[model samples]
Target chain A: MTRIITVALIILFIITAGCALFVPMQKPVEQDNRLFLWLPGASSVQVLSDWNDWGGSVAAGGIIDPLSGRMEKDDTGLWTIDIAGLPGGVYRYAFYVNGYKWIKDPLNPETALFDGRTVSIIMFTN
Target chain B: MSTSLITLIILIAGGTDSTDVSIIPENWVFGYDCLIDASACGDWINNHPVIDSTSVDAAVSVSAVSPEVNFLVTGAMRNDSTSHVVLRRARGVVKWPGTPWIAAGVYLNDQQPFIAGLSNPVLEWGWVDIDSTKGFGVSSGGVLGFSGDYLIQLTSGDTLSQLNVHSPWMGFAGVDYSRARIHPADSEGVDITVNVLSVRGDFRYFKPWLIVAGAEGEEGKWAVSAELRELRPIDTQWGRIEIVPGMHFAGDNIDLPGSAFVPGQRIITLGAFLESRRYFVSAGIKGMLDLSSDSLSSVSASAGMISEGGITWDVIFGYYADGDYRAYVSSTVSDSYASAGIAVEIIDDSTRVTGSASYSPRDDVCAEVSFSGDIDDSLQPECVLAVTTSLGPVMCLVGIEWEYDSSPSLRMNLTGLFK
Candidate 1:
């Protein structure tokens, strides 16, 4: 019985390790049709875009916007969000990290000069 | 079970758009156990009601933006059949950006009482950077807050004055002031800090600290530093080996409220570390002698190897004069992106074994399993399995555990962030 238990444990360990190494894990974008975006090492990340009035309206002594609610993070310290069903056009956007720190998307290099500051851009088609 | 359900209901009702929720009852308990083992567990167990006691903690972060607000609540049920629910932490901070920084915050914390040898909660409100290079803050409430603990700090170039004044409403009162300066003298870097502490309305103690570090050889390959407070030896590092030695005197009492201080004991420590391209080793010894002539000593050694394929493994061994010997091995297989570790403790004649394994199945999900129990006596071990996953705007955690001589239990937690 002890030998059998040891063998079982070894087999389980091998199987788990093999699955982790060989299996192609599903990407976030592959699981959904929306455009998947990722940002790393951000405590909290939010999307600010022209569609959400650039998150300029101050509420509760801070900026509030519709898109800010859509951002989420995963286990790998990567904040991910999906934007679906948007019209085919150029959209100006930026990311707000930890509420106050703002910057263009580090992953997406496509940027444009907006309001004397650089902002990220995303293009969509029909 | 009913209590947990009620807590969840209260959380849901009290949640707001700015509110964020986190729950980890199982993880919290496990962490508490780890802390108990590291600190004076015997004293803690003896002082607190440990039998049939349950602990639950929850925190909410409100207003994720500038001037953030947070609230933490904790619940505990003692063995005496009495239950208590306390608001452990409530704080808010506001920030302003520019060349001259300005920030303010207010806080009320009551959680310190849960630990052994601590007093009541505290309420404090203060501001900083009222001036560009100088500012003041104030605190009130609690043993640490008597005389409202006025604070004044100044920054000018590489020198600053740090003052902590504690004039509490009752009990011990004192002031602690420290001056620090950083300067470059010739080819070396020098940092000096001097502190004067006065308690019971009298100046009673003084401490001075100095550190000088310099680099030599081409490309700054060799670096050396000497630190002196109570005679710490010089530390020098060249190619691979680094040595450090230090001694501390504990005869004087200059402890600040809310600070952990061990008095009337002298401590000495010496350690060395060596590293090469693919292997590293470290060893250390620490000893403490109290005024009563009682002494305790501990020694530890660790070695590690790193392979070209990114696999790394390490083994550590430690021995204490109190008849405690511990050995641990940890390995990470980068090819599989999995990690595992096992620890064994031999106390007297009995042996205890604990092990854990973790793997990330995907970028968004990870799973962990852990087991702990006596190895020599019985094979009945306590096991726990936990999985965490992120689904768009929501994060979820599920854990199941089978404790020794107890039925299996499952826990689940969910957190959502609102834009």
Candidate 2:
């Protein structure tokens, strides 16, 4: 712990002294408050999970809402959803493609089962 | 606090200028999202089984920064007997976007947000589904390692009220407090008030959480549950192992409004899971005890493995102390363009078997077929065929299903998204 703090302090000092060139580039990580999927060819993508009642599958009439947790597509074929302002809890989510197929988040290693389907798990904090 | 006072405060906050300076917001801003979905399905059942024929749903969500606003409106129409067209799930929220941002949530379906508990949540288990009510919520933090979300909801007749305060985490375990009171809609109805508290923390190696709740002026109107989740994982040369333990106790008259929690029960559970590091194999076993009756409640075990040839097989078995049991087994094989799987399940005195296969000729299109039947002929056999494809900016699906005693069903779906 002491070593870690000392190294952090040294790096802060170097950055403050304008010699921060020694800092190394780090690998990209998954953002805590967002979800991402890359499927440029898919026409639609929605997050079907334990939250939103599995896209309302278990609601009164068992109607599957097509836009429940809908994701946005960018020019680069990436689909993303911003889950900010969500109450902190654990949620199991999977990308529902074209209204049928379920795709788990490849970047997330933790997994859980939701109604016999494998979904990605996230520990969300406000 | 009075509802009138709350309304006045929100109105006052909204009238203030929100363009004071550059916004450092992990916050809402000028944007809009919308989608429309349409589908049709028809089924002929032996008794009376036919879909409403078609359903259409659309939603629009918009946000802005200057006078901070975020709102969503959803409407749906279905074609059927009593074909009802409704504008539901509509919610409007206005934020005073800054530190300690104030916000209000008004929704027809009461999808108001709240923080319950991470593990053994006594307040909310899955989705936030409450009675029809309008709620005011206030939230702050995600700054300086402190965050809190609070909400108060009221019904029109002032017969129902709920309050929730949740602090996710401030470099440690989280805390929660919630209260709910309701007077039945009908005359001569009883009144119930429940207060709950939950605390959960994470340790680097494992996590332990607990919850306790009680209702005022009621005998045995209380419940408590605790669990040590993700506990005791040991790594070895061959694989990894983990075990979790938990227990529950509730009073005879406890009425914890949740979808899955039993109100009159004392139960204990122990579960273990193991995964092979060098091979594609995993196994799990769980046991439950009914402490109230001092008997075994149920036990279940599952195992799965994959072979070098890319063939996967899995098995699950369950046993209950009441002399009921179930067994399931399945195997699958896949290649670049196609995959096939077969499963068998034994429940009660009958066995069921199902087989399914899918072929994806290209990245844009796929077709699938499945069939299921029972060995004892008690359940009529069923078969289904479906195809999915993408057409530029739109995706489409068509499916046909048939059974022994009913006419075939045909279904089609089309979906798209927009800014």
Candidate 3:
């Protein structure tokens, strides 16, 4: 059982790492005024953020409009939302998937807490 | 006259320190926002609601620093149909150089509930405890490596109190535990008590957050959620790939009836994505499982890219086990002077197409026009024209909207901030 667990852990690490060793490591020049999610198999994505009162959960009777902050998906299965018009300040945002799941922006590393769930933070200075 | 005399006495009692009271504070700032919006359309539709409004609000803040205490008092006023003014924040904290401190008057209280997601029982009960309220609290330097700030407050005969204990971050880990309770004014109303502890840890490979929360009001309830997130990513030629997984579970009565909490519900979330350099090419899939129902729940998929020449393109799709689906495709391009985009969305059978364009002469100003509608023979189109500009210290947005079966709505907003 111990040997089996060790082997399983190794496989998990390799899968999570995913070919980075074979290719030269690089950092993508991520966007500051946009959000990205790679979920080609999913049907919809909405950005629920402090900026929009968590997609109006309190005002909309808990049913968030699936189209709010709707990101455009391209042929490559990546979803992107343009937020260039947002004012300069600190903001917390998360990706609401399939109407129920709350996931933070993967590309941004900064995090803050709100309503018990962890969310991604972005600060813009004009 | 005697009531006014009492106020003067109280003012004299508070000015005993070496720093004497003054008529005007040494430093002050003023900020304001003003807007006027109106809509008028040809009287074709009488049932549609139009937007017309004029609003103005301003706030003044005074800050004073002395050897014994620091004071920040703010007052705000607004005018709509009527004009009114109120004291906003009267935060006077005795700094005395650190550790234990005492604060009174209108200060901010941050007592948050430990609720996750839209499960919502917590949200209904947790709400925001009190934002700028008349209260008193005492802070302690440290006790057993944890600092504490205990506070008690009263408003409208209801008593709300909190005991917050937190450990400073040690570069890798930190924890905070808070106990808050509300005693209703009514003799028969049941009191509510909430206890929550949150721990955040930063590891070499991942960051993990754990929340354990419970509350007792009408009944006792408990909830827990764990998340392992990647704060940063290392990429390869095909770009970077990331996976985020989380789990949440709660007692059936997490909130009250009519809240977002569905009884006996549990959710497991997982997502994976890959994006190329500069995110010029990317794809991702994310989904949530309904563990209580033993069902596949809902899932979504998307892919998008921006070409090197600045043309943007994207496609998104989603599906629920209940036969509901939506798909969208769009492309857009922009330059320093002009931009345009066209897109279509299909939800079930209905389809909507949208086209938009914009022009900008300088960095601080832009004007845009857009039109969209369903293409099902019976035309229902919505059109909008808007311009944004900044004049001096104030920013402005003015727009007009004309929609089928509705009167046109016009709006203008102006905002200014100075501190």
Best by TM-score: 2
Candidate 3 CAPRI category: incorrect
lDDT assessment of candidate 3: 0.58
- Which candidate wins on DockQ? 2
Report the candidate with higher DockQ, 1 versus 3. Answer: 3
Candidate 3 stretches greater than 4 Å from native = A1-91, A94-126, B1-52, B65-70, B99-132, B141-145, B155-157, B187-190, B217-220, B231-239, B256-262, B275-283, B294-296, B303-306, B312-315, B377-379
Query: Which ten residues in a row are the worst by lDDT in model 1 chain B?
Result: B31-40
Q: In candidate 1, what are the lDDT values of residues B196-314, reduced to their tens digit?
A: 23222211221222111111222321111111211223333421343435443333432212111233434454555443322222223333333333344566666544333333344
Give the per-residue lDDT digits (tens) of candidate 2, residues B1-419.
22443353454345343665543343544444434567889885665557857876554333344457666544444444654645545567766666666666565554433323333234442233433455566655545444555555555444556666667475658877777766666676667677877777787677676777888776988887776766656877666776868787888888765522466789888878775555555677878899777455989887665544444466778899888899988766644456688999999788999998877676557677889999884778999888887544456798888987769897888765555
**Chain B alone, TM-score of each model?**
0.47, 0.78, 0.75
> For model 3, what is the alpha-carbon lDDT of residue B179?
77
lDDT of 1 at B405: 72
lDDT for B200 (candidate 2): 71
Name the docking class for model 1: incorrect
Query: Could you tell me the lDDT of residue B327 within candidate 2?
Result: 91
